[model samples]
Target: MRRAVIALVITAAGLVPLLRYHPNTTTTAIRATAGTAQTPSASSKAPSTSGTRTVTGSEVDTEFGPYQVQVTFNGSTITDVQIVEAPSDRRSQRIAESAAPTLRQEALRAQSAKIDTVSGATITSEAYAQSMQAAIDAS
Candidate 1:
């Protein structure tokens, strides 16, 4: 009985650190990026949306940090997905750089933000999709 009690104490001791440990994560206000689209000009008042237009998506907060994407449309088709502000952490940056292109392609090809997310980039993928969808909605 005493040995069992000691083993239980050891197990609880091992689990304490795991429960208390917290990884560093960042959260900050969204800032405009170079890729952010500008307001349309008076001359750009098209009866039909033939010209390209860009829309910024809503900021999404994820485990690593805040992320946002800007989407551009050529008429009704999505032509681009720009990572206006991806997660600032190094790990997130690497993941984002790799994921952004694929996300853009998928968004363009799908003509929507509802594309299959990259396997290892769940947080980035979700933020990308949300931001793209926001742009599409704005259009």
Candidate 2:
């Protein structure tokens, strides 16, 4: 009984902080949805930088590795987004292959850092969103 209680205490101690953590939301709604690969078309171009400013997000560490993003904006509107850093692990590579395009598309469509979380890539998605928020804040 004592050992079981001790184990439970240890588990709770570790998980509580994670549960209480919250990243500042940069946009309105972040719908949790299925992750899909939606690569931008070759002809698709982000907004021109002629009248925009660029800002890079802070590096956000996740369970897998570090992640970051750069955002270009024309005044208050987000013009384009670029992934500046992310994990290169094999599993992360496979997940990013699919998740990256989807995330980018979503960001463009929404025009903000706030994005729907990818179902299978929760950690990466959260980190991505947070980093996006950081960039916007800096911009």
Candidate 3:
């Protein structure tokens, strides 16, 4: 009985830290802009001099952090996709760093945001796709 009681106490103690641990759940208030030139208004869409247009997507709030992207379009063709914002936390940073290239490649290949999510970075991938789609739509 005494051993069972001690084991129970230890288990409870182990669970205490798990219960106390809280991740960053607060959402940021960053907004996205659509334009090659920096503009104050979110609705403004400016075309670059080289006949390409860069459009920034709306910021997507995820459990990790805000995700956003900027897409450059040459007429109707997507020329580039750039991550404008992402989670800065160490774990998230690692995941983003590894996943970004694959995601970019997929987006470029698909010519849209309908790309598969990275295996371990589901949340970030979803957020990235949403932001990328928004940018594509804006452009």
Candidate 4:
């Protein structure tokens, strides 16, 4: 009975950090390693037909391995950018998590491919930027 109790305590202690851990720690670590700020060049622009449009596709050759992004645009401006697929590694996941908001905000506001990169995941940011640009390009 004593041994079982000790094992339970150890298991609970081990789980404490994992459950209460702040994801920001990973973001901080990634930022320390990968400097932020990415700007994508302007690709050729195409005319839009009408109404709101959504483009969905995946970019295979991304910095954080294979990633998929879905982009939504209204008229000529992007309204949303969502990460449909992300990396398996924990560090990469955190990077992806950090970049999503930046990607969406910049894409919607800028209405151009010149959105700034995420603080930690420059490559992942670039990949999202490029994929989003491709969506813009397609539209």
Off by over 4 Å in 2: 1-50
Write candidate 2's Cα lDDT for 34-111 as tens digits.
232122223223433345667767777665666777777775677787777777778776786678888888898898
What local distance difference test score does each model get?
0.74, 0.70, 0.76, 0.65
Global lDDT for candidate 4? Answer: 0.65
Best by lDDT: 3
- Which number leads on TM-score? 3
Please report the TM-score between candidate 2 and the true structure.
0.60
Q: What is the TM-score of each candidate against the true structure?
A: 0.68, 0.60, 0.70, 0.60
- Best-to-worst order by lDDT is 3, 1, 2, 4
- What CA root-mean-square deviation does each model show from the true structure? 6.6, 12.2, 5.2, 9.2
As for lDDT, the candidate ahead, 1 or 2, is 1
lDDT of 1 by residue, 88-138 (tens): 768889999999888888888888878989989987888788767666666
Error of 3 at 79 (Å): 1.4
Q: lDDT score of model 2?
A: 0.70
- Lowest summed lDDT over 10 consecutive residues: which window, candidate 1? 29-38
Residue pairs that clash (backbone atoms under 3 angstroms), model 1: none
Clashing pairs in 2: none
Prediction 3 TM-score vs. true: 0.70
User: What number of clashing residue pairs does each candidate have, in the order they appear?
Assistant: 0, 0, 0, 1
